[model samples]
Target: MNKKDSIKACGRTINYEIVYSKKRNKASIVISPDLKVEFRAPHGISSETIRKMVSEKAEWIQKKLEWFEVNRLPDHKKQYCEGEIYLYLGREYPLKIIAFDDVKEPIVSVKDSELNFVVPKKDSEDTLPLLIKKAVWNFYSKRAEEEVEKVLKVYSKKLGIAPPTFKVKHQKRRWGSCSADNVLRINFQLVMAPPEQLEYVVVHELCHVIEKNHSARFWKLVKQMMPDYEEYRKSLKKEGWKYML
Candidate 1:
């Protein structure tokens, strides 16, 4: 079953809906079209706590019915365009779309620190968007892999831990994940985020090799490596999600 169907409420496996507002940065629980329960503070709150908090405020749920109505743009469907700015390694670069006939595959080029998208003529404009996106993603994915290798070399040497096998994936809900088998999965879309964000994601997952959960000890290790991680986390919410199409 889906998450919505799996969650239970008030001793009943009732359908629970989550309502969020970017302006408020808060989440509210609503029961179908009937009721809404607002959580005043949801930052860093886990799902179970959210559910329990909602249950405690079940009485005001009906009163906040209007908040249940919300509309949001579909994730990462925004089209890439020339002059549109993107972040790479904490720096902003303007997108320059170049139409050329000599190149067979879409290529992303950086010269004097300016980024450009070079595409062949055979690819139709209708398909150009996807091509450009793919080209960019591939470029960044390779870069992320390379960066991971370099960072792992440095950290492993310092920590006296060897680099372990890791997989690269494009996760919609998370930047990275680690399995019980010690296999690390890094998100490919992370290449679109700033440099510090990308580094945090990699290190965060690597730390998971030692501590599987986000307990205080895990964060302590992360902070030892990256003291500015909280800023990076907040930065991801601001613009990092745009990486995936």
Candidate 2:
């Protein structure tokens, strides 16, 4: 028989498999689709030991699923209308659609912290919304570059590593990441967050220069730079809806 077999644990039948890896120093239990549990063990670890570990940690695995369900991103089906409030950086602003003449294309302008989008007076609200999205993309792309540079310079000196090139993207699940090749990619959605949170993410990615993985030491480095990062990290979870339009 294959290593994978059905076993009952915690009043539930867990379909699982065992695999060995040379790079793994510890046994890890991964729950796969159809609720199949996989035990990834270090080379030479016994199957019996792996099974015992899985049985013992069944509660923890269930907790992980509970947490995932609780924190899953909400469906983004919010309806947008005229004069709705939106935020960029730390400031709040009302969405204003400025009407134009002569069939001019829509444009966005910022004056004294207020954002205004130019659309023909006769244009449809649908057109205005599309223009606003395009303008937001352009505006945040430039701002993201500037803000990233500001935070990178501070952490690069503290970590004693050269700053790497950065790219701005609209990432789905991550706020930022640093690759092994030293490229730093930041999510443009951060433009919707407050300035302090954005800076925290920057420092978080910059700390990856010293440690690639999310090890304890990596978080220690982040704490050294931003002492209250734990609070900010929780804030990201609590106020996640505010960051979306």
Candidate 3:
């Protein structure tokens, strides 16, 4: 049988699918030229033990992924122009931009496999592009507010803690964070990832309500809420370049 699992390695989450064989004696990690990670192992090994072993070797795995990243251009890079492919909920959607001065806010919606974007105004030649890009981003942040809140509510109950005040916003390098004052801040770009990936971030932040740091207890609490969360985290990291505007 094949199983999906994740390990925190080199301060990054590495998700891999594992194949079990009764005859195999040693577990090995295989990295495809395209950077997909797979593990082959003997049967009857506990997941925690496997995770520990993988974590020990995570530095190597992380370096391999980085090597591939450095050697190749990012996959699905976006230009924020018409005909560009965009992602939402892990699905691809082509971008379609329209400008209107009548509206006060940028409007973005998905319909018929298109990311329909409406800008607040049609500006002068040079400024229009920047305006549209900013507007499109704002649309993402707004939608994140709606979508992320629903997930936070669901996981909040599962964790048996009152959902704290949270906001969807931009972070230059971080995905999500929980403040010392008990507020949760999620990345707006996360809405473009798959639902499970988004759920993982929400659960990760919500768990902070109980465990303030990424200590052993914090990870244990996270694992309790989502056993496959590391897989999602790894996935998000892998395809993250394609998901942003």
Candidate 4:
């Protein structure tokens, strides 16, 4: 069963949904990518207990909500038109489109601080947006593949562990994750971020290969790798929206 509810967090009313699950042995709370909050509890838990748990977690929940509010992407879709700014390596580059009748395939390149897209003249106006998006994604994916490999090699030597295999993927909510099998998956969107931030994520997931949970030992290892990782994490949260497209 599920029902909607509201709670007070830092004197603000935050709404969430409550789901009663027979299979759940303990209560859990989750904040979705769209910033929707949900509380899942075992069937026999009391409403009062649930409210207490939410209240106890109020500060953490408020921080997450604030982060989402600051970093959430714009509601409207991107048109990928001229003069639109795109992120690459933490810098902004304007997009420039060129049409050529002799061109057989669309080509995307970066020169003079601009992301240049050259395409067939006939399809430039009608299909440019889609083509530009695909081109941009391909560029990011390739960059992520190359950069992650380099960062992993550097950190693997320092950590004294075998380098884990990694792949670039499109992910909505997470920047990167490491599986129990030691495979690391990085969100291709990260290629748009600063190189230091990307390295921080790589180091973070590499530590997870040693410690599966975020225990004190895990963070200790992370601090050893990058003492300023906290700053990079906060920067990632604040500047993440620019790379969302």
Give the winner by TM-score: 4
lDDT of 4 by residue, 94-154 (tens): 8898889999877877799998888888783677789888887888798889899999999
Candidate 3 C-alpha lDDT tens digits along 1-245:
88899977677889988878664678888875467788889998888888888888899999999988778655543567777877788888888877787977667788988998777664555765676687778878888898888987888888777789998887744688888788999989988898898889989989988888678998999999999988998997787665556
Clashing residue pairs in candidate 4 are none
Model 4 quality (TM-score): 0.76
Off by over 4 Å in 4: 1-35, 38-77
Task: Sort the candidates on TM-score, descending order.
Answer: 4, 1, 2, 3
Scored by lDDT, model 4 comes in at: 0.86
Model 1, span 104-159: residue lDDT tens: 87889765566799888787878877887788777777877877777667655655
Best-performing candidate as measured by lDDT:
4
In model 2, the clashing pairs are: none
> Which residue pairs show collisions in model 3?
none
CA RMSD of all predictions: 7.8, 6.6, 11.5, 5.1
Tens digits of per-residue lDDT, candidate 2, 1-245, equal: 23775557666665678867554578778753224467877788777777677778878767665566666555553243456666788677776666768757666656665677777778777666666787767777778888889888888888888877899887854688888777889987787788788888888888877788778998999999999998888887666556654
Better of 3 and 4 by TM-score: 4
Give the per-residue Cα lDDT of candidate 2 at 89: 82
Q: What C-alpha lDDT, on a 0 to 100 scale, does residue 223 get in candidate 4?
A: 96
After superposition, which runs of candidate 3 have C-alpha atoms over 4 Å from their true positions? 1-70, 74-77, 99-106, 119-125
